[model samples]
Target chain A: MNYPNGQKKQINQQNKSVKTNNNIFSNRGMSLEEDINTTNTYYLETDIAIIHKKPTPVQIVKVNYPRRSAAMITEGYFKQASTTDYNGLYRHRYIDFEAKETKNKTLFPLANIHDHQIRHMEKIVKHGGISFIIIRFAAYDETYFIPAEKLFPHWHDKLNGGRKSISYEKIKEEGHIIPFHYQARVNYIKIIDRLYFH
Target chain B: MNYPNGQKKQINQQNKSVKTNNNIFSNRGMSLEEDINTTNTYYLETDIAIIHKKPTPVQIVKVNYPRRSAAMITEGYFKQASTTDYNGLYRHRYIDFEAKETKNKTLFPLANIHDHQIRHMEKIVKHGGISFIIIRFAAYDETYFIPAEKLFPHWHDKLNGGRKSISYEKIKEEGHIIPFHYQARVNYIKIIDRLYFH
Candidate 1:
């Protein structure tokens, strides 16, 4: 399928062992990450907002200074970020969020997010900034914009002997459904406008 | 010298040819950066703020998958960041800024800051966030927290065929002088609280 962004969405092959929801339109190859990136780029290119996905943090252990120029990192490790994958200014407000994709149709596991990330989000919310998660049920090719408030309960519940994951049905009912667009594939900001701006 | 952070300040060797102000007590080995990093860490541990310096952005060109584990990047290049060095949430507002040090005591060169970074700061300011530069005049061992508003005129001057830098005398008059603290060496946030909160 061709998106308004003028890019053709490549359908990805599915595994027979996993449950597939054929009812929803699947734009498989363009992962949830790619969609969000594309959306952010569009947002930036237009001057709507100055949002950016932070570069994957790397801890450089060793570097080689071959000349009086840019030092080349020789040894490094992909440092697990203490914060979210993306954060930037939106509508004059601080915005922070994480995006994840799961094949499971019934549940979105809390394990996909790190403990530090939860704390980071909690701080943003406490400070009155916006925090959220973008989850893609890849099997069904559906995505949802769920605020941090909806997510915090699931994290706390794990300790209270509650379900370790949020049921898809619960999320569908509580979360804002992100519509797929031709240009802005996962246009999550539309929901933000309604939730916060209005 | 032992700082209030309970750490010894490591003095960096100075280039003799460069300008040095002997009257200002120089923590010779401890660069301005080390002080700021130490301060930030202290802030985080004390639950003051969750600010962080974004890792230097690097572009990975080649990677080697030696085993079924971590991918080792064999080739990469440092990418100039379009945004500033540090940013985070402060009192429910987005804070973004850059830090620069200069040996020249008379002036803070406009060349040190990029054009895009100025634009980035402008956007942050326009969106109700705080944006500024923490300029450390090494010779004087003096740092100034100048808001984007104060810095913008200097940027615009260059385009109008005016002088391309801000003189130290002018900066001293216009900027908030950041006092050197034992623990929070670059306590720029104190100025923020004064300027924004008060």
Candidate 2:
């Protein structure tokens, strides 16, 4: 049953033992965030790579004491993050990157990023850190890792009356495509090995 | 003015600036966190190194709106941080570390760190990142950078009835003493250069 338009329903929908006749039944179950979290967990469990999704930043203002032990949050608001979603160390080098998923097939919109993120990436690159963007066109099941240096021209051009997005064709040519697997949904380390190591 | 138990009067007596006679106050009147932030700003500006203090984590539960545009955070609680306070890149090498200040002149207590943070630092070192702890004997105006390899043994020794603290004298002998300038309160990169690069 659907709730009112503005109300969010909290449901525990984790039961998965039922026999399903169609692939859509299984596919319809998982949310994008859940799948990505699972992939990150898998990455962490294995010695493959060390990257983490930064927790959403929230500004807390008040709290209520329900009991001696269980203090509950009473008030808060979401805060804009100054850094990218993912950053970690890999193979003796600093890895800093932002991950974005788009449903659009034609182009990845520049509006997905903020100006502060661009400046942060610029600083990261200037300091000799490996910085990039991980763009996932989920509609096409395609993911690409584009270096920040390559994206800077597009960012500047977008400010000067160019297209406000990077077309799929440009990504196909410029960015390294990441291979997907059952465990590593966005196996970006492989792309790093191909581009930076070898 | 005096507080109920004379606490305010005692604190007020100690509130006078220690450098009242000097023209310059080194490190300013900032907390350890703020001093690191200012040092990071100086590092970023000078192309010396890149470092940042992670934002405090808060778990938000509710928000209120009395007006159209002004959102008031009414309920929230601070979540204890799982990672260290600072991390960054230096000379293409990943750097991960935590900074702690203690008033105890004889020993630096290990109770300031959590188990998860130690685990995080271990992962960082395993993946080729430079991991360390920056301990400040604030009473003595002394800061030292102790590498993770040196810390791990102490962590394990605590389980075997050994001392749960590292003495300042031991740190002075074993760890690298980080020099302080008027700008960089925790000038760790100099020690890093002497230890890692040189």
Candidate 3:
């Protein structure tokens, strides 16, 4: 059975899993980005939210427009993003967040996030938008939602010659654990509801 | 005089204009995108609003890791954007909009916007976000902000075998004219202030 253009890749992936006899659990080893993307798709389809991950920023320096083919980017470089990754509207509220996963068992380093992104989140919170970060402990298979307000004091401490990272235990204490659902794998919206709504 | 990396382009453009003796006005022939970017920067600096044009989406096919320099995208194709060109939080409201400039003197063609973008804008409006489109008539140097609600009727008409374009006069009557300012070039936030905040 042949699939259309967009569905082809998905069908091929499933086939590969089937060939490996790994069909029982489809999302066993999915990356954090893939899980969030799948969760976002489910949210959009169910009309629960309209969150979207912004595309990776690239600076195009050269292009090759063949006579019959699409315009191909021949030279490009990645640029530092000026804002958070995921943002949209949920329950009539502006929602913005960045998601990161760390393989370390003890701590999540502050260096994973950039300075300008922290400033951007501060502005978002000041403007009354709901801003947060999703931190995933890959070793423990646990994800936590930490509000921008909660992360700021730690960032300031690091700037003032304090610890360079947030301990896993500290995150477990301060952050809300995001439960995984089959459809909404990351399921950060549940945490948003608890934080922002009643 | 040596300029920083990002400042080099602006300095070069200014020097070119000076050499040609066309330095009376720096923004005489700027595109709508450039104007809006400048306006957003001004708004950000003044702490008035937070808006940003999302980066152009590209489907990267291949990349190369050089010995000492940056990773280069050797092959890629532009992807159709799934949402509006710009979205951000303003005065606690989620602001979303698409900007387009046309050389057509009498009408703005509906083909410039995609079906998915229209659906995206509709979802935004239904979710209580402020959604609109910025239509610029380059021939007359006039830009108008048409609310998503106002555009829906015209889009439906086109879908029902009616006129394929919205007349310039119709847009002028239905849309708010965005005033030009020296710093905030497009200045759509002024129109937003009147439409929503008031």
Candidate 4:
């Protein structure tokens, strides 16, 4: 079926299952971002939550006003984000967080996060928002929801000349494992529902 | 005087007064956006609120990575926003809003708002977020805070064979007039506090 904009129905496979394709399907299925987008779409459709990954910020240096229609940016540069990439209102509360995927199976490096992002998360926390980080170990096919509260201590330790990364064991111990759901792939909100709201 | 970024101590005049240079200072003052940003900064500094204007969204088509320190976006376009430009956490409540300025003094044409923005505001209201529009009549030097609850009705009316523009009288009657403070220029949050929190 073709729509006006060639819009196709999104294949939101909540459950990790497909026909005649086990390992091959699982490996090529979805990225961490795709999973979260699918999950956010489900939450929005069901009136459970409303969250969105903000559009990538761009600084346009030049634009052309081609007669009729919207203006076109001819020259631009991607600006370093001063805050996290995702934020929204959930259950009448502000929810803000960042997501990262690393192939390393042993640890999630602190270098994955920037100093300004840490400051932004801290501000969110201080202002009574639910803040967290979603760290996915792509090598192990595991994802963890590490709350800002759990991760801040490790971040603060850097000032005291500490380890620059959180060991995988530490993440598993401190963070809640987000299980994949049939209707909501990479259901981090399930962990949030259990940890924060409960 | 020059403290790195021309930083100066903000004088948050809650009652909107300072000295003899009333009209003079007001004429040579900051824009609505600058006021909001400075206000957000003050709020962050004083631990009052944590809101930010999401960076402008740009769609990058091509990038030149010439083994340099940064990549330059060679082809890009400014994308229309699917959601409001500013959002944040305020007193544990999710707050989101869009700002617009018009030189017209009478009616605010519905053309200024897109269909997607109306839909986005509807979702925010449904999801229990405080959503609003800051309509500044630059000609009249007046700013009004129109809540989603009120604006959505007018938006829906347009779809139901109603007027495509909202008259100035109607807006002033329904919307709360936002007073311009010295530091917090467009103090729409004051109206938010009264309507949502109070």
Clashes of each: 10, 5, 0, 0
Candidate 4 docks at the CAPRI level of medium
Per-candidate Cα RMSD to the true structure, in Å, reads: 7.3, 9.7, 9.4, 8.7
lDDT of 2 by residue, B1-198 (tens): 223686555655665643441214444355677677878889988878878777776665556787776676666667888778778888878888999988898999999888889988999999899999988887766778999989988887886889999988889988998776668867888888888888
On DockQ, the leading prediction is 3
TM-score of each: 0.84, 0.82, 0.88, 0.86
Candidate 3 to truth, TM: 0.88
How far is A63's C-alpha from truth in model 2 (Å)?
5.3
Better of 1 and 3 by DockQ: 3
Point out the worst 10-residue segment of candidate 3 chain A by lDDT. A18-27
Interface RMSD, per-candidate values to 1 decimal: 1.6, 2.5, 0.5, 1.5
In the predicted model 1, the residue pairs found to clash are A4-A182, A5-A182, A5-A183, B10-B29, B10-B30, B11-B28, B11-B29, B11-B30, B12-B28, B12-B29
Tell me, by TM-score, which candidate is best: 3
lDDT for each residue of candidate 1 in A70-127, tens digit (9 for 90 to 100):
7787776677888898888888789999999999989999899999999989988987
Models sorted by TM-score, best on top:
3, 4, 1, 2
The global C-alpha lDDT for each of the candidates, from Candidate 1 onward, is 0.83, 0.78, 0.91, 0.82
DockQ, model 3, C-alpha based = 0.67
DockQ of model 4 vs. true complex: 0.59
lDDT of 3 by residue, B23-106 (tens): 223335889999999999999999999999999999989999999999999998999999999999999999999999999999
B139-158, model 1: which lDDT tens digit per residue?
87788999999999989999
lDDT of 1 at A105: 88
Kindly give the stretch of ten consecutive residues in candidate 1 chain B with the minimal lDDT sum: B16-25
**Candidate 3 residue B45 C-alpha distance from true site, Å:** 0.8
Show where candidate 2 strays beyond 4 Å.
A1-33, A60-67, A70-75, B1-18, B21-23, B63-67, B70-73
- Model 4 Cα lDDT, one tens digit per residue, A1-198: 232343223222523333323333242357889888988899878988888898887777888889986777777777888899899977777999999999898999999999999999998998789999999999877889999999999999975899999999999999998887766777888888898789
